[model samples]
Target: LQVGCPGFGYAEDMPSALQNAARTSYARKLVDEATQATIEEWQKQNGKLALHKAVEDDKWKRDATKVGLLIDAERDALTRTDVGFRLPVHLAARGHASVEVVALLLEFYPDGAEEKTWHGYLPVHLAARGQASEEVVALLLECFPEGAKAMCKDGNLPIHLAAMYEASAEVVALLYEACPDAMAKLDAGQAEYVEKKRKQGAAGAQAARESVRALLDKLEARETRDRRIEPETLPQTEEETSETVAEAA
Candidate 1:
């Protein structure tokens, strides 16, 4: 009976603009309702929703199935950010969220990998800083390789953070491979590691710098050899393509 309803009635009865307006209005109403419900749920949980808690670092219990159920319950919450502008992916990277949970979050918001915290830390940076498993780190890096080059408010790239936080060699290597220039900054990262270790204790101050340097040197050499073997693999030029076509003929 609503003559001006979206996708309803005969052509003469409803104008295109009117139909679009009605559709937009209805969609907006749905969005507003979902947003309000999410707000109330967050308030009920003391400023955090189930999605936020689902990916937090909790040691008592870890259930990927339950996490999947919660995520499926409200997929929209995947985009909701907390006070720090940290998405669920950010929490998943920094917390105990399983790799599958992280993947699910990415599936919902592929751009979430490039999203940064207020401090400019990409999910890759947090994953490295939190010492996330190599798989998780790899997943985040794969989502946005540019994240490897992003610098946080402290001016530390993901590779810098990975080395400073003593991430596994494999993790650091992933970051290094994502951005080859990261190798040139190893001295800066070594300084940070030394300063941090010195503040903790004088015992391993020199040793900490040595450790980071060792990892950096090792990965750098390996990457150099890889580059040498591959040299470069850029796309063929027009001339090269024409040559190939001629040879085929």
Candidate 2:
């Protein structure tokens, strides 16, 4: 009707409500894009910012909510089924605790049922490579008891990894505490073999061999003592009687 201004239909004279709505939409889009770019930049900067920023956003508490949403939405596009195994490992290597992630996998995936990379590492291997801390190692050991002994494609165990990378001494100590055999395995015959191989020119290697030999001797003594006990605690068995009978016979 004539009550309404005829100029209202013109592009310049569009309703004030529509103009305000368009501006707000544009502003919101810009803010969203900026927020996304910030997040990506933070992630690229070694995860520290992401870890801290995670606390600020409700959707990022456990596993970034946006990532989780994207994964869910595009799960069909994922070609591989091993993301469950890969994600936790990546997180661990990146120095994120993700304890809950490890626990969830262990609880859901049966022992030895998990898929692995070409190198045969379980999530524990990733954790070992990540921080090499006592707490992280302990958690991995708890989830996969034998994970400490798991071998990489190069035949290096978790202990080997720790040694090669010079990881935390405390972590190496913790792993040795859990499985003393690992030390023996690492030093097994390596000292004598190296000594035999070096004829004359390599003094440094020879010294390393000697040091290793001394270490092995101490380890052997400790292991022997640890395995030995008072006879009172020994279990009675037919083999004990058979030995006694053989001596008397």
Candidate 3:
């Protein structure tokens, strides 16, 4: 009966702290219905939520654990499109998210990989243009190899942008192999990029282009061999396009 205690009255009105003395982990159902409803309302207004920002923030972009928690908070955020008609997965790829983060997003929205932005930028196209790491690039291509054949608003395939930006050889190679009938594009992409760099006075870029070309020699040889041996099989299916390259490499 602490009737004289001044703090007791305010403490009663304050929200109680979570009781976690014995619990080391929280259940996945952490967001209350009211809070989730508020979140949905906000999403309706803004067409985005905390989950979308989580992937774009550098602090949490690579932290799979934090992203997984955001996912657990609102799984539907995966499918929600922002005003730009872009999903969280699309931002994740464009932001150079880590392999773990990319995998987590894909787990929730496997079809998100196929989604394109208003400007026709697929996840793979963004990933390649941003020069995302090899593992991340490979995963996007593996998920939607058709992205290689897709041209963005700039009329450039993922490989074209990747080459123009001097992405890693591994990433460029992944895009190159994923495209069907890619030799023409590959050859043109490399020569044009090298020339563009040379004209810009980037003497170092020519050497960079050669380095990427060096790694792709085996692919070039295999493609030539296939054309001579089985010229009739000119146009392979999407699956064949990617798988055949994987096997050849």
Query: Which structure among the candidates has the greatest TM-score?
Result: 3
Model 2 regions lying over 4 Å from their true place = 1-87, 90-95, 105-107, 110-115, 187-249
RMSD of each: 19.2, 29.3, 22.8
Give the candidate order by descending TM-score: 3, 1, 2
| Model 2 poorest ten-residue lDDT run | 1-10
Q: Deviation in angstroms for 119 in model 1?
A: 0.5
Off by over 4 Å in 3: 1-47, 186-189, 192-249
Candidate 1 local lDDT, 1-249, one digit each (tens): 112111122234322444434433444455456654653464467443667766874731155544544554566777788888898889889885676677656654577888889999889889888988666776676556678888999988987887778876666666665776766766865645534433453333234334434443443353343323231444578998899899999
Question: What would the TM-scores of all predictions be?
Answer: 0.57, 0.40, 0.58
> For each candidate, how many residue pairs have backbone atoms clashing (under 3 Å)?
0, 0, 0
lDDT score, candidate 3, position 218: 36
lDDT of 3 at 148: 75
**In candidate 2, what are the lDDT values of residues 36-146, reduced to their tens digit?**
565566566624234333322344434433333222223222222333434333343334434333322222122321235567665556555554335445545543556
Report model 2's TM-score to 2 decimal places. 0.40
Q: Write one digit per residue (lDDT tens) for candidate 3, span 77-100.
A: 888888788899889988988866
The candidate 1 region of ten consecutive residues with least summed lDDT is 1-10
Assess each prediction's global lDDT (C-alpha) against the native. 0.62, 0.43, 0.64
